[model samples]
Target: MASKRKTSALLAVGLVAGIVSPIAPLAVAQQLTTQSTAVTHTCELVKPWGLLGAKNQGTIVSPETVVVRYPATVAPGEVFTAYVQPGAAAMRTTDGRQAGLLSYDIAFPSNSTNLAANYNGGGSGYSIPGNGPALVDRVAANGQLATEGPFARISGGATAFHGANSRNGDAVDRWKAGMQVASNTTFRFPEVALKMRAPVSLANGSTITTALKAAGQSGDSDDPTRNTIQGAEEGGWGTERTNYYFCGSSANAGSLSTTTVNSSLPRYLAKTTTRMVTSDTLLPLAARTTNLTAEVSSTEELMSNIRPGGMNFTIRHKATGQLLATVPNVTVGANGQATASYTFPTLSNGSYRDEYEVTATYAGRVDDIESSTSEPVTVSVGYNEVNANVVLTSTNGALSGGTMPVTLRAAFALPAGKPAPAGLAIQLFRNDLPHGAPITIPTGTTTANYTFPTDTLTQAQETRTYRYRAEVVPVISGVDRFVGGSATPVAAIVVGSSPGSPLPEGGQGSVALEGFFRAPQLVWDWLTGSIGQAGAFSSGFAEN
Candidate 1:
């Protein structure tokens, strides 16, 4: 009983430091012969799961099988999920003694790129000869219980080196089985799975290998892995097999192949600069062409020389959040500069000012660079310019059928060679509200004229002056855009010579009227004065 107690004590002490070479001291080779009645043997059987097969069967486990599998090629910053598996166990005892899987230790390659981010242990498939049931056994890693329907999760997902072993920096598993093995003449062990994760760095070629340690330590005898199995080999002894089957000597034969990081896969950095080439908001019917300039460059050398048609520009309506167009395949020049343009449709909403937000994307070359998109930018589409004068064909300030003719001229600041538009129309407003029928600008002409009858103008009891403004309306099939001061109030008709309230919405998305929350006292300021002081409405209105 004293000798039996000593052997059991030593066994526990050895396996704790991670499975290694010669965990127990041979000097005290367990004087078991004097204490136990069971017979013993020095010969051993190498589990058939190993590659040596029958060649190593009769000998004390001389060949080991530790295999590794994972993706051989990985880019920088990619997470590598790798698997390390030790050989299955095949042990036998003529006297009805049992021995099988419990725990083992594994190590990762020592490299700067390998990180200890994730370590998971699990597996399935096993056959219990004594119990006659197909069972599943696995190492529970990172504080998880094994799914074997037992409490076998000893201590896995552990990274402590435990000792002076160079590979311990990534040690995982000091795990144990939940149930003791049942007596059997021969028992089959279960397959195990250990997974680890690390990110690849900026290396041209990095080697990722996982190695398994062995129990057959010391150069004194090859049969050391044998240990005269007196039933104590069932993990009763400190020197235990991962499967308690005398897991032979280990070799570094199974390791992952080299992983290569491509040059353009995840290497180069990129930037895209945007500039509004047209300078200001386009005037309605003023050649709906909105021009833009893009500077697309990369941090890598000679990237500016990339061929044309690699960039795309996306334009979206700010008011309605609708996709207008994607100008595809523009080319960047030697200076990392490119150009893009979009012809906008008429703004559909008359009350809201419309702007086109643009974003540029660089479709990098598959063989050399990666793709990227630029920050977004916006430019107002249209805010028309109107100059008006009133002409009366009847008595002045006439309330009856007197004809009031107003000549409307269309003009805009367009690029050279770009013609001022035709096919556009203007709508008149009587004091902030839409008033008359829309007038169209005939093709081949830049001017539109409309005369209104007197009865259309309504009056209140007090002597009042009616403020009138003509706004360019969307008559084309596409976008109709605008900004604050819907249309400058050009003329006023006096009924009794009394003026009304100050117009706050004159420069809508342009500025802050001049002071206090509402449109400032200078509500009638021209477009310049209108824009600078009213940044308050930029989100909904603005002028070039």
Candidate 2:
């Protein structure tokens, strides 16, 4: 990885006075009377060639910038003081060997700026030769120099050196230097201040913002804004160049400072709204016999906020809070809205409430702001009893085997305390008895008299008899109870060679006939438990 190194200098009063005494004791002492200088240096590793393994080469092509500043003033030759402190190496490997060379580009902006020729009196002090160049060997490593650049430019009041290097064979690059100036001219000493900017590698981009938007949020200018700029690998150099410029401002200058980062714009996704449109209640005399319907409406505002392909709609029973049904990801129109309907059947009669919720998920984040739920819709159903009456309308009940003309009429009356039945079911029995083999009756507006065939009886039998009876069973809405009330009176007929003849007589005939009539009463008693006495005809019959 690429890295950055910084060095700061803090000088003691004793060292400052010692370095400036040789120029002219009185002049240096006067210039250094009350002056303080602070120097800061920053080194940044850079790769202009974009070559791989360049970082591991142990030869760092870093541009070092320095900012020099003086907190106090001094008279010429009065021991103008400055100091340099060495910095740590810029790179380290697994083996703990420090690697790389330090190269620097120093710019003074004008030639008027000056440094002492031999501040240390040519002993252990840095020297700038008048003909050749200022060169200082590395003290920490072994082969590093203080000044390596040949690019020299004089402008304004300073001279600019384009590059420099240190040759420390110990694999560690350390820059160590310091200076105290004594001016030859009779002038006041100016304070020296240094400011530097280093470019560090930010290979991976940074995160800026995260947000949520409610459903139906339009493309209004109020929407959040987001914008980003690619980082630079190599740009302008020098101590004054800012790092990570934003809108032309150097608000972010330091390396890897999270506090300086902020969002450029906001992002919103998946906006939606839901509501209950209609609800109704039903009351049937039987449990699990009622049907209910609920209508719901949904609308979406933003298109891109919607998940790719579709969205999901679900209905839940609020009372039990159980999910009734789930409709998976449905595609919406460009208008960003859609509507659907649902019906529930065979629902048990009781108080029930249900709610509907819609969700939209996109790009790994569920946009909950756009999600919505409908108000609870409650439905109550009560027991509703209605009378179903079947009447044998025809007086001629005698018949032959093939296509006998028989008419059975049926009608219904609304229950005493309930509304009219929405619909009815009618069944016909074979032996004119209740609860026997059934024949389905078709629904109709008015009382229907259906004509069909009756079972054929053998002519060889001495006694041929047929009976017809009709029942009026009460059917209640939203309830499971089947009520039997005022049935049509039983009708009987005796079939013999003569149309009108006295009832045929035989031994034990009266006993056998009574047993046959009592059979139906026994069956009705077992089904309903209404019959009380053995051979009781009136007990099973409806009173009304």
Q: How close is every model to the real structure, measured as TM-score?
A: 0.26, 0.22
Cα lDDT, all candidates: 0.36, 0.27
Q: lDDT at 467 for candidate 2?
A: 42
RMSD of 2: 30.8
- Give the alpha carbon lDDT tens digit for every residue of 112-222 in model 2: 112221112112111222322223221111111223211111111111111122111111111111111111211111112221111111112331111111111211111
lDDT per residue for candidate 1 within 1-544, as digits (tens), equals: 0111111111011122433332221221111111111111223332222332112221122232334444444334333434443333333344433432323333344442332222233333322335332222232222122232111121212211121111111112121223234343222223233222223234566554443322233221223222212111222222222212223222322232233443233432222233333354443545667566666654322333344437778888776778888988888766666677667776566633367777777766543344567777776655533322222121223333322222223232222332225655555565578765765545434333454434233433232334455555543332332211233444333222123322343312222333223444334432333322233222211111
Deviation in angstroms for 336 in model 1?
40
* Ten residues in sequence with the least summed lDDT for candidate 2: 225-234
State candidate 2's TM-score. Answer: 0.22
RMSD to the true structure for each prediction, in A, is 24.1, 30.8
- Residue 442 accuracy (lDDT) in model 2: 39
Residue 400 lDDT (model 2): 52
The local lDDT score (0 to 100) that residue 285 gets in candidate 2 is 21
Off by over 4 Å in 1: 1-64, 112-202, 214-248, 254-258, 267-544
State candidate 1's TM-score: 0.26
Could you tally the backbone clashes for each prediction?
Answer: 22, 47
